[model samples]
Target chain A: MKIEVTSQMTGNVWKVVVAKGEQVEEDQEILILESMKMEIPVVSPDDGTIIELKVEEGDFVSEGDVIAILEED
Target chain B: MTKQVVEEQNELKQKIDKLLEKKEKYREMGGQKYIDAQHEKNKLTARERINLLLDEGSFKEMGILAHHQNLHPTMEGKFTPADGVVAGRGTIDGREVCVAAHDYTVLAGAIGKVAETKVARVREWSLKNRVPMIWLVDSAGVRVQESIGSLFAGNGRQFFDQVQMSGVVPLICALMGPGIAGTAYLPALADFVPMVKKTSYMALGGPHLVRSVVGEDVDEQTLGGSRVHTQESGVADLEVKSDEECLKVIKKYLSYFPSNNEQKPPIKEGVERAEITINERLAEIVPTNPKKIYNMYDVIKELSDDNDILAMKPKWAKNIITAFGRVGGYPVGFIANQPMHLGGALDGDAADKAARFMNICDSFNIPLVFLQDIPGFIVGSKVEKAGIIRHGAKMLHMVSEATVPKITIIIRKAYGAGYFVMNGRQFDPDYIAAWPTAEISVMGAEGASSILYHKQIRKAEDSKAAWSEYADQFRNLIDVEVAASNMLIDDVIDPRETKLQIFDAVASAWNKKVERPWKKNSIRPV
Candidate 1:
């Protein structure tokens, strides 16, 4: 299954934790967002390989923006 | 004895034998072929479900011989055994409960007038006896063939009766199969609704009706499947993989709830003794750094007895978690903010979820435990247009109106209105506590600094440096000790001692009582 991890809040990408094609476990931080003066991590929804990292570090993403795509195990 | 007396006794015996044979035939349930088909679909027969749910040899079947009374020429030879419903009183875990299992093998489990009467009778028994009402819904809605005319207006008394039963008794509805149109409402008004993964669905209109009425083509699963309801719509509570698991989940759910609102939840006395032990994992589970994320379930596990937390609407509103678990063997509803999603912030959906769960807990006399790591409700124009104010108000209303014992734990950030809705000190939490890492403030220090010292920073030679300096000072002042000194909270405790502190408080408030000035009811926020 393919899952799109979307941003729950509008924020700047503090850092990209995983690269494209990297294997990540469920809840593994794929990226971090700086929002509301808090560093919120966007975690993988399931154990999967990250097919795409849509945002880069320092990029501003709005709420509902796709952060990454995962191909689930 | 005379030959005439012997013949008369033989005749009575034959009549009794015939009645038993008729019941045996109805038990076949649309014969072997349909039963096999149901099994192939990974579903259980109505009788099988009832058998699995109730105690051994405890089912007292009712209306087993019931059949439809529709006299239309098209239905002249139709045979609908039990009128497509298997209903009776049975005991589950030694407690009596009324069950109505829709038999999908018969007439596709289309509900007819007779079957409705049978279900209504069971519902009456449930209400009159103050026992829990369980509905194994697998119906294809009303029998449209029999009521193809204008008499549908007089029907729908079931939902009205359900509303009356709500809050008074635990009304549990499990969707084991398709629940189309009117049947979908069974779970809507229910206190607990669990749907079978692939086999069950609930929609206001089935595919056929939907296509013709609105001219949109869609399948039943896509429209109202377990995923759609449990994840997207928040209509169902839990989605189980199979029929057996669904029934087991129901039994487990009932264990946490009293049969009726007049009683307190059942306790596992053995588990109570082990609840107060301080688990070192609790300290490791939560991060002292507010920005660093941690799973709230980890924290919940350390507090719950046996680490068993039956979460409700877990997939939807992922920001908030509404779950039933035991602390000190006493059933409690834990409403915690999930930092993994939305930085543990409360939004419209999160507030709605918490509000509804609060009503359920408060109504059933279950003590509530608030795990506050909230950054407060979501702000900005997008949420305002989504009616966040009114939706957020529901939580405030429920938290204030909830008369049950409330225990608040400010683990990290308890800022803004989130504190109030999450049972802040003003909300009358019986024993409110904060941890050493707790930051109880009106707002985040950074945001408050920017607003409060906007002029000071503007006048400073280096505005950015001045702002940071001011923000650092404000951040230090937002500590738990300030609240402690002001006596705003009960006490600040070590993170490792959370389980013991909560358990002792819950045990003490077991016999809590609250009296309110009587009114019909307060008009709560929608």
Candidate 2:
């Protein structure tokens, strides 16, 4: 199953913690967003391997933007 | 003569024996086997639960002999005792309460036509007598055999009555067993729902139905157990270890509410101020830095009498704290913004939570106390798409319509529309007080300054230093002193005198009859 990880808030992408094809556990941080002077991490919703990274560091992503895709086992 | 008299007495004895046999059947409650099964599950029988809930020997059962009258072949021969429910009037700690406990032993506690009527009748009684109602729901939905025509048509009355009794009398429900399909509405309508752990489960559709429709293989526990409802869904208010514990929790909860909307909450004697004293640490509680988060609950505890607070919907919309507490031994509702969560912003969920709570407090005539530290309602496309405007309007409508005495204490930041909806002077709050730490403004200084001086700051030799200077200048313009000087707030009070000020305000407004303009009713934003 392919799971789309969406940004919950609108913010500038501060850092990308995981790379494409990397194995990630559920609730592991995929990327961090900077908004309202706060760092909010976008975490994986399920245990999966990162198949695609949609946003780069410093890219401004709006809420509901798909930041990455994870292929679940 | 002696022989005739003896024969007559013997005949009377035979009539008494038949009456005892009927009473024995009533006590059986679906026979001994089912009763044993309930015990094995570590659950109290319906009657036993009622006995535990009410004061000793205070229950007066209303419909003990009620039974199903359906003549269908399948139901005709069945002996559905008490119509699978035991409803009655009872006293919990000398306070009168009506209860309807479903008997799981009887036909799996299915709601028959007669049982539905019995439940509705007790609800009406509760409404008329102005007594709180308790529903011990453990039904396996409606009786399938009797789910036809008028029987199905009349089912809506139960839920309708629940809505009618919503703010009038406290409606509490305990989920002791499966509450699926139609039965689930009981808990949903209740002011408070306490579900027993492990055994209690509720769902609109059961596992079998899910499997058939969605091809999901799930067990009943995994689908709608106490853990899921209490922790994830926010449907159940509390989870207890057993049926007895659930009853105890309900008793404690009802003690904080009045019997009906027309009456004031019963006051507990000897409830003194907190022993630790609030005055000393009150000044230091709110940090000087605007970005730092402090616990709003700690402030509430300091202001409340004896640190007593009964929080509602604690898990959902955590940014806004809604609770029932006392000041100077008088009941009042506390609506505060928790800076610790989401910077105390009024999001859609927080707005909905506060609005509903305000309506309840207003209906019951409980005074309102707002401790404002709200930054503002959340902005951006995300919240807007989530219908923040409609949801946020609910708070405005509720605050405007609330007839109860309102006192707003601005402890920290009160920016933008958050100030207006949090019972600002425009809302005609009875009293408005502010602490020295309060910063009342249209928006936070940083955001306002950045927007207003964007060009100048960007062109400055040092952009960060330029932005900070502009922000400080903006912040100085809207401090607590400015607000007080402009007469926007009633007074800038000392942090230590907060509880006394709130108490005096509520006490003074207690008997003042304020006339409201005549209106049928205003429409609330949906």
Candidate 3:
């Protein structure tokens, strides 16, 4: 079972640092979102593999949107 | 030219003669000791700190000469100014504030007979002025010499004023001395406290006093250091290396929220930093292998507002990362988990730290950001016996009751109780987004596979191999589009588009904002 990485606050998907199938540790910055002149990095929960990316660059989001999923280690 | 030079010298000599007379007058009053004490007293003056925090030339002096001179009418020339505490009014960042800085050189900054009155005056002035109060505490304790007649005096409840005003008005304490005895409680009473290391300490009593009473040798540093209060106890909000650093941190903390809940915060010019393409890099950030721990800081730095991110209690809460940062130009609260520490599990200290922070943010109406990377609450006999359940529940209550705009970005694990506490679907977060590389499941693939297919795997030709094979099947690689295609989560977002979506959601929440319609809710639930 893996955990999905989502945006904590709403913003634009400014950049996606992790690629699908790449490995990630807990608290590692997985994705970056720009909102209200701030950049928020979405991070991973466990030592896991990135399985998918949901939102694309320039897409607007609200709170609780899934940005990526991490298959647990 | 020679004649003009001679005239200038004469004027300069006259000026020097006047200075000598004034110095001699001060010397005659109580000899060099009095002069030395007075000059030394000025070194701990709040003038410098006040200037750094407030706009220049904004501080207006109040009760500067309001000392105990009235009681000793016969000794008219024996009056002291402000009784070693400089209490005054000032505009800190255009917001009105009343500040009182203790003069440490004056009898070790002991509270005098009338010192409490001066502070009370400042506190009352702040309440009347409808402004925040800043107390620069560097005192040893009460003045034992003048403690005789204080009972009859009317200033016994000065400290109580601070306590009463805690939730009523914002109180910030900057501890700049070896915080001992009573000074320790003052900071604890305030909403926020920023302390300087080595120079600052907070203790109910010095270790020597405690040791004397208990017959144990307790060292001072071990008893009341910045590390103990900020890291272990969570008494102080911020621990800075120097006095200057402490002042700067105080300014930054006050910048985010409004002066009070009744008002909206002033939107300052937004931060300007080099914008990097952080969203586009998310695809390669989270690893495909479930076991490898990727760098969450990279995503945090990318998603953070330029240089607005300031992580707090970093050493204590290794699992949950709590920070103070800004969105646009307004201050907001940021909480995330780091899988690197205890697999991003919530512990007792981390929960307490985040809970208190959540209370403050929610009370002040600051929006919350949850970086959900939590496996679950820490289990095991040690954690349970240590009261992890009660402490973890505190964090849950704070998050759920927080009425401010909340957004949850689940970057990785959100299993069990950690899911709900992190503002999952149950909390009804304003916006919920997930990345394409998400596996929304409980526990983990390894545990799930063992529980579900243990008997079947044992029957296989190779039991151990079958277990591993079954675990792999539960992995995201085995089924990529299962959760998203089913629409279990609201939407799956690309890493690059995450920022834009968060902004939109916050905007939507802002637009849909409806404050508590009742009489501002009577009680403050802890």
Best of the candidates, TM-score:
1
List the candidates ranked by TM-score, beginning with the highest.
Answer: 1, 2, 3
Relative to the real complex, the DockQ score for model 2 comes to: 0.11
Q: Any idea how many clashes model 1 has?
A: 0
TM-score against native, each model: 0.95, 0.85, 0.74
Backbone clashes for every candidate come to 0, 0, 128
Estimate, for each residue in B16-60, the C-alpha lDDT of model 2 and write its tens digit: 887778767886788899999999999889999999999999998
Q: Model 1, range B1-526, lDDT digits (tens) per residue?
A: 8999999999999999999999999888888899999999999999999999999999998999998998888778888988899999988889989999999999899999999999999999999999999999998889987776887877899999999999999999999999999899889999999999879999999999899999999988889998789877999999898999999999998888888999998887776555377688988888766667888988998889888899999878989999999987889999999988898988898998999999999999999999999988988888999999999999999999999989999999899999999999999999999989898999988788999999999999999999999999999888798888899998999898998888888889889999989999899999
DockQ of each: 0.61, 0.11, 0.02
Candidate 1 is scored at a TM of 0.95
Candidate 2: tens digits of C-alpha lDDT, residues A6-38: 876678999999999999996588988876655
Q: What tens-digit string does per-residue lDDT give for candidate 3 at B285-331?
A: 77765555555666666675664577666645666777777655546
Residue ranges of candidate 3 with Cα displaced over 4 Å: A1-73, B1-44, B68-80, B145-160, B270-278, B281-285, B449-470, B476-488, B511-526
